[model samples]
Target: MKEIKRDLEKFAAEKFDLIIVGGGIYGIMLLLEAVRRGLKPLLLEKEDFCGKTSHNHLRTVHGGLRYLQSLDLFRFRDSIKERRWFLKYFPEFTGVLPCLMPLYNKGIYRKSVFRIGLPVNDILSFDRNFSVSREKHLPGGKVLSKEKTIELFPSVDTNELKGGMVWYDGCLTEFQGFYIAALKLAVQMGAKALNYVEAVGLIRQNDEVSGVKGKDRESGKEFAFNAPVVINACGPWSRDTAGIFEKDYPRLFKKRKLLWNVLFDREALSSHALGLRSKAGFVYFFHPWKGRLLVGSPEKLVEKSEAETVAPFQKMEEFIRDINEIVSGLGLEYKDILRVYPGVLPAEPDGSFSGRPAFIDHHKNGGVKGLYSISGVKFTTARLESDRVLGRIFRHKKAISYDEMLSKKEICCHSMAYDWQPNGEDDLEILKKIIKEESVVHLSDLILRRTSLGDNPPRALAILAKIRSLFDWDNKKWDEEVDLLRKQLREGFPNQKPRGAGNR
Candidate 1:
């Protein structure tokens, strides 16, 4: 892969077709989509790519299994389409994941509902395996016998446990590396992308948005890029970013909620990603990610400011208690949480997450022309959503399929390389190449965002010195970066009390 070449001068010099703000999944996909249609696009990120909410997912790609609840065939097909896209295109980065939900005798969580539901789902998604490789192919959902469910999940709560319904899904195996790979592909296809550059404001001439006004966070130097059109795909901060449009700007979010997943540092509970309903009737999922039990999706209305993404301590305690209650003998507690991936997402007034992706053209809204905003709650359909947004722009040229690039071997940065190392550090050659290309602005960029050493803060701290030789930082600069990375880790993984004895 060619170096990401962080060039501010080149950014200011180029006159682009589109200027995309926000380097999260949505923004990155939009940038790639623009390029695929032969449009020159410039993408800017305030921090490293996927540094915030995008990196906080459970890494499981949903295939609209829940949409079956309401018989939403359109969504079911759309989800299966995107899930298949991820599997077929990025074969190295995506994988088939079987997800099981423990069945109960009563309520909607029973086998009878899914027996019909699964067949309908399978029939609608008949084309799921079209063009997909054999290894990545998804199997039809099935109803497991109660004895089989007991065999798989030995400690499951048996109060009314009938059996289980297991469905297939996809997951990002490379974590943030998938984000980085798509970004690298965009850059290779003649798109310009820069990290640590903030889009401060929009440059509007009359009613048309001329371009984006940007500032380098490291140097405090400002620059402007000219583009006829601009898009705001800035996840949680999208509201704040588009706030510049002022009153009459349509409300982007009806409501907001704090969504988070906890990476419990315990042995994984099952081979298949498991879902179980608590006594409170909230269905919680347990994902087996990189040997840890990744449990998630506890949500509440946005009580705190959007910036406070760290989940509340009391809420986390409650989440742990709920999980423990679902499976007997699985006595988990707060300290068992090695890392908590938290983010803010748009929600409905009743606290249900907004299902649809929203994209707005300001000109249509009677606001600034040549400017648009997009916010999507789910990551699985980001590419499809971007294609829809850009399909409106360049209507003639078709969006390129990622399957086209299958013949070529693209460069990928495995962010979690350190995790697999027998020793504490990654291979020196791999680290050297990452430092040379992938825009290494700080130690935290490499440790946290670029490589997932940040997933386990304490482990990242332990391996910090081992990789010190990769950076050219002097004593003082090195110490400063280390301190900053430590502070960031502490904030993301708060309440670092040790796991109590016999708590497992």
Candidate 2:
């Protein structure tokens, strides 16, 4: 990993083949694809890499099994292909997660539906286990007896507990690390990826985009980079970014789905991810990760402005109440939550889950030359989506065999020496390396995104002084960063109150 500040001068001087805005997983994928094809690509992120929507996923490398509901085989295969890559190539950050969806009635959510669906799904994903390691290999789905379901999930509603269906899926063990690893690989493969760099506007030659003008958050200095093509891979912010140039940009963003996932401190399940329908009939995933209960997906649409931030306390309270009602044994409340993973995703014009990524060539659709925008559907298929976008961007170029480089396994930042220690005292050497290379402009970058300390509030608070000492931040700077992090945690965490007590 290299610091963006150190290479700022070179970055400004170079005329690159492609300029990608947004340092989320989608941007990272584009960077990787660009470099593999021997194209000079520059990646810019307004915040820390993977700090926003990309970091707050359910941690599942979806295998397209969910797409069966819509009978979308194209998306289903795409997910299976990407999931296979993660399970086979990045075993360190990906794992086989067994999921159980309990059947309660003789409707769509019944055992008979799964009994036929699982085998068909298995056939569709027949090549899923190809070249995958034994330990990471995913097994096909099977029906569980009612008694077995009761044994597995003691809190399951018994009114119509007609057994359950068990299926296998892949989980992203450490998303922050996994994303960083991908970016680092792209950097190593001759792509320039810079964090904390915001692309304020597009540099256009007449109607065609030439490059971008960006501001470095660390120094507050603005710089420019020239490129023939620019891609808007900003995920939820795709339309907003493109709006800088093209007005009436086909309204790429139809609706913003505010997806929220809550993590509880206490153990909610012994093992296996439990999929249950909420009282409102929406499917909720109750999965165990890092000793916490992860539940989500009773999605609600919100205004684009409010979609980027955390959900309101009232909404969170409502979610908690719904969960409590569905699984009375857990009896969870807002106080039990450790953190709330909140993010916004692009939806169909009618505000439905399209379940497929959208790629737009601004030149073709919006009449803006040399500009393109991509809105991804899910994290699992980001790589495949990037490949498709690249195919359109470099239309006639034959792809190089960079499989070996792309597939190389990497250790996530958290898995480095000193492990989960948030305080810098535990491992000074690794801490210094991270601070220097990973572009630590703020304390939150280190604690919240780069390390696991941010996941645990008390631990992050305990290590503040140590971090201050390690980074050599002045009192004023240290205080500012700490205050900002506290504010962010308050909004991001479930237990903490929103910014203004009177407002909430």
Candidate 3:
């Protein structure tokens, strides 16, 4: 990975075939594809890679079973293929998750209708041995008696209980970990990827894109890199950045909006993801990971101005209440939530899903012949989306075959291998060591992002302090980081009061 960084720095000093703006999953995936094609690609991120919506994911590599309702067969097929690909290539992170769909005596879809849909889903799996009997990891579709339903989901309301259907889907244990792994792979393949570099402008000559101008956010120094092709894979921010180039070519731009939400710790209701019909829309996937449960609302169009807006606090609270009311076994409250995040989904103005099918537009009239844009793909389909975008950018040539790239394997970039494991008895000692080494401040960052402590927050502070004691930092550094974290907590979480204030 370090070698790839050095090579990228060298390429940036000269010229490159591709300069990709945005370091999220889309940008990183493109960088990987380009470098594998022997194209020296430079990737820039305004913040840490996967720091935005990529980090905030439902963690399910869905097979698009829900899309069957909309009859969006193309997306459904692409998702299933990609799910299989990820499971095949990265089995360590991806796995088949058994899901239960508990039915009520009074509900929308009947058993017969679901039975028909189940066959469609099975067909979409390409006859690849996903049957319940063949795949024991997944529960087969069966109607359970009321007594059996209680055994299956003990917490479900018995009064409304009917039998339920069990099925299978794929899940990623950690979305951030997956992206970070991909980033490491891209670096290994000779892609230059640097985080915290903000792209400020598009360098053009006579209305053609020549390269990009950016500033190192950490150092506040500006730098430039030249490339014939520049890709805008900035997710929600793609349109805003593309508009800068579109200013020179007024005829080539449009925008659209999309919204998603997350609800945590509500997964105790079912062993696998669940789908339910709600008055608002279809509620799919009550996904459980580690200890938290996540639920998402359907994707609906919103105004561009409200694109980045999050679900209101009250609305999120209501969502939690409603979900709890629907799912018998799961019980949660607003206080159970750790955080709420919102991101935009970009699209075009023609009332079509601009990026859903992986929209790619080339701007040759303005001098930048290789400038391309990719938008509208969910996490499950990132690999295929990247392949599609790169195919368009590379003019439909096989940039680098997947088999060859996987065959030349040089490194194993697994986080679990490097992460600290505590001897059951020495957990305190290990925790202290981690805190000391990382100089952790806020309990949330320590537990949530850094370690698994946030999942069980009651012991987070003590664990944090223990971890901190292991580091040999001077009192001054400790105090500084603590102060910085306090300020961050105050600003980032205005509602939550500081815990154990006297500890400071």
| Winning candidate number (lDDT) | 1
The alpha-carbon RMSD values of the candidates against the true structure, listed in the order shown, are: 2.9, 3.1, 5.2
Ordered list by TM-score, greatest first: 1, 2, 3
Off by over 4 Å in 2: 1-6, 305-308, 406-413, 416-419, 422-426, 492-504
Q: In candidate 3, what are the lDDT values of residues 1-504, reduced to their tens digit?
A: 233242234545878778888877788778777867778778888866665656556667777777888898887888777777666666556667777766764544556667677777776666433322233233335555667666766765556556666667777764544665566667677667766677888887765668888777757877888887788877777766776755332222245444444545333455656666454555566665553566765344566575244554455556667776776446665555544445555556664445363454655434355677766457677767777777767875557666677666643323332123443556655455434432233333344443434333333334445455554668787676555444432222224433422145
- What is the C-alpha local distance difference test score of each model? 0.80, 0.78, 0.60
Model 2 clash count equals 0
C-alpha lDDT of candidate 3 relative to the true structure? 0.60
- lDDT per residue (tens digit) for residues 1-504 in model 1: 767778998779889999999999999999889978888999999988888888888888888878888878788788989998888878778888888888876777778888998888888889998989999999999999988988887877767678998889999877667777788888888889889999988988888888888999989999998899999988877877888543323356767788788877787788888988888888788887866788888986875354457777778878888888887798897667767778888877777788898788877877888888999978898999999999997778776656564356476646453354425344767767777888889888887776767676567777666788888889899989887776666554446643321121
TM-score of each: 0.94, 0.93, 0.80
Q: Between candidates 1 and 2, which one is better according to TM-score?
A: 1
Give lDDT: candidate 1, residue 21.
94
lDDT of 2 by residue, 239-295 (tens): 878887565354566778887787676775848898888777877898787656888
The positional error of residue 80 in candidate 3, measured at the CA in angstroms, is 1.1
Residue 153, candidate 3: C-alpha displacement in angstroms: 1.6
Model 1 accuracy (lDDT, Cα): 0.80
Q: Of models 1 and 2, which has the larger lDDT?
A: 1
